[model samples]
Target: VELILIDESLHLQNGIEAILTMVEENPEILDDYHFVENIRQSIIDAVELELNYLKTKFGGTTIFGVSYGELERYMKYIADRRLIELGFNPQFGIDQNPLKFLQKEDVKKLTNFFEVTPTEYTNF
Candidate 1:
């Protein structure tokens, strides 16, 4: 089964704006690879290209382990969770997603809920 993973850091609006700014200023050679090889941010900046992923290319998809692909990125945000065992700082973008609270075995059970498929929906 094939799976698709979405990286919201670059997939979100904030990351798009950064790329547009670079192209607007250098209208000449985005053709070359050096134009936007660097970026920095405290929280989320969409792609946060500073991070590395050999599997993921310009088109899309990133790996987050075998079962992780089942979880949605923003299904549960920090929203100010008040637990210390999770150890996720409030400032961190993920801020203790439910996955963090789950033990390894518990996470494995998640596979029962998701499987890869060629298409999700035909039309609305």
Candidate 2:
């Protein structure tokens, strides 16, 4: 079974939203200017490497890749909304999501917990 992480999946997006909410609530916890950028670059590098390996092993297969900037924009949108919900203003001026194809119905379907089943467990 293949485990896929979709761009608009609530599990992934909500985690990011929570983190940004935390940061906004307690700005002193993260003082580094490059913190978010570093984390974003690391995720981009890791995903690109994994996707490249998959492309090499499974030749002729089309692979869809999301850029670090695109992912950041989506996460920023979620974060901004979350901040507003928490009675705080949005720090990031991202007015739109980069991945516009992920509609509300798609998110609803993707986030349906009953539709997901764990195939295997791996200790992180």
Q: Rate residue 73 of model 1 by lDDT.
A: 30
Native-to-model Cα distance after best TM-score fit, residue 3 in candidate 2, in Å: 9.9
Clashes (candidate 2): 0
Model 2, runs deviating above 4 Å:
1-8, 61-106, 109-124
lDDT of 1 at 65: 50
Clashing pairs in 1: 9-46, 9-47, 10-46, 10-47
Model 2 over residues 1-124: C-alpha lDDT tens digits? 1234343354656866787788788887566658655655544465556556555654654336655456556656755555455445665677676777654433443434567663332322
Most TM-score-accurate candidate: 2
Give the alpha carbon lDDT tens digit for every residue of 1-124 in model 1.
Answer: 1122222322433455655666678777455645322322223243233223322432245444523232333222422231122222443345545555333322232222256432423232
Give the TM-scores of the predictions, in the order they appear: 0.23, 0.41
True lDDT of residue 3, candidate 2: 30
Q: Tell me the whole-model lDDT of each prediction, alpha carbons only.
A: 0.35, 0.56
- Give the Å shift of residue 20 in candidate 2: 1.2
Candidate 2 to native Cα RMSD, angstroms:
8.8
Candidate 2, after superposition: displacement of residue 117 in Å? Answer: 17
Which stretches in model 1 have alpha-carbon errors above 4 Å? 1-11, 36-67, 72-124
